[model samples]
Target: MTDTERTPAAATGRKQPFDLGTGPGRVLVWFYGVFTVAAASRSIVQMILDFGKAPLAYVLSAVAALVYGFITYSLVRGGERARRTALVCCAAELAGVLIVGTWTLADPSAFADATVWSDFGRDYLFIPVILPVTGMIWLRRARTA
Candidate 1:
């Protein structure tokens, strides 16, 4: 058995690139992608249909969509800088969810409709609330690994 034959890559059959395509990253990317589309389209449609009805909610949804889009892109980019950017975005996302969730609850009349993070993302199965937390954790792990 030569040294080349005993390498980790050889033992593992092949060496896969360290990217969001690997392991939990794959799932995270998928979820972020879905949310990006969902939030963007929803906000666009809502704004077009009746922006005056819920300007705050609709604009917030659009902002959330942009954030999701950026995070998704960062994750797919898959590098140290991307990981750090994603981590920052994820923390901002969590903060947005908490702030908006509390605001909506505190003053129901302030929001004519629900944003993606409304009710702690109850409308979206709480994924908006949970995603950032998971993303932060994943980004931290990916950075170390």
Candidate 2:
């Protein structure tokens, strides 16, 4: 299959992009899916139990969840449009990580608790910071593949 050619899925006859959900996209899908679940779960639990303690942190985590979920969905639903949307989302996610990471660091007392992007994802091994960059690179390459 070529970049502009889409092959029908065996079971559904739905056309899928030739370049997406293959090698690097597959890895991105996995990581994004995992991050979606992780961020969503953490935010949900924190909001329900201790939102009063750190509302900003919890809300930011939830926002990250929504972003991750959208990107994951876009990756899985491959098409030219989806790829473009995912690339844009990856850029937004990268900005969020950097901004939130710096905010948390500059004013540690700003949050009573840590968000997924806290200290550049210190508790999560900085995957929050790294994943978006990888995703953006893969997405840009996928556009030409």
Candidate 3:
């Protein structure tokens, strides 16, 4: 192909740097995706089976599922804007986890059932708590990459 026809990155002979699909990012995406499915499914079942039992916890679970879904989508999109969006979402996810985790611990009676973030995701091996931190670190590094 002629130089004029070459893509900018190709013309410069520099391969495009990896985004969320490489190395640890790939793992992060997988975790987010899994959480999206898990949280969403759990929330749906809980809402259907026991909506009046723990409305707040169930609603929060649904929200967490949505956040996880968005983060997963952004990571897969793989662009500067996507990375930034994912970073912000990750921060929000972390905050949610911490707040909900503490709330559950402080007043167990408030939640008739556990959310995904209950006790810092004790039901899910604490992955919910750790995932955001890992995602934040990965996003920061990807920004520099």
Candidate 4:
């Protein structure tokens, strides 16, 4: 169906103000949830399997996972601070992926194992590399809308 013909009744309302965690926001929320689950699981597995092997990398992974979880929470909550926090978290996530991805590439021996940032998240189909960019775009759209 066409856009005009397919819209739901709730979407044709007079309450046109942007609801960041509703409608399209719901899709972002689902992605954030998935990221939270993936990051948390990876961190937990890394820590459990071999923390002593690469303490710094594993700890950073855990921190990144926690940050992802917090971002997920903030997106679902939907407020000024929540949006701001989401921005900051997305920026940090981008930075983390870049720095770690570069480092892992520059010296694979140092990592000695895979990380979310490794090879630009080749293992995760590069969603870790792409998510922050998409998040920043979404956040900006949400803010301006």
Best by TM-score: 3
- Total colliding residue pairs, candidate 2: 0
- Model 1 CA lDDT for position 65: 96
What are the Cα lDDT values of the candidates? 0.91, 0.89, 0.93, 0.80
Candidate 1 global TM-score: 0.88
Model 1 scores what on Cα lDDT? 0.91
How do all the candidates rank in terms of TM-score, highest first?
Answer: 3, 1, 2, 4
CA deviation > 4 Å runs, candidate 1: 1-17
Clashes of 1: 0
> Which scores higher on lDDT, 1 or 3?
3
Per-residue accuracy of model 1 over 1-145 as CA lDDT, tens digit each: 9876678774767653458547998899999999999999999999999999999999999999999999999998987788888999999999999999999899989999999989899999999999999999998888656
Q: Write the per-residue lDDT of candidate 4 for residues 26-127, one digit (tens) a residue.
A: 777787788778877888888998888887777777777887788789888887678888989989998999999998889888886677677777888998
RMSD of 4: 6.3
Write down the TM-score for model 4.
0.82
Q: List the residue pairs that clash in candidate 2.
A: none
lDDT, candidate 3, equals 0.93
Best model number under lDDT: 3
Q: What's the true lDDT of residue 55 in model 1? A: 95
Q: Please identify which of the two predictions, 1 or 2, would achieve the higher TM-score against the true structure.
A: 1
Q: Write the per-residue lDDT of candidate 2 for residues 15-55, one digit (tens) a residue.
A: 44566677888998898899999999999999999899999
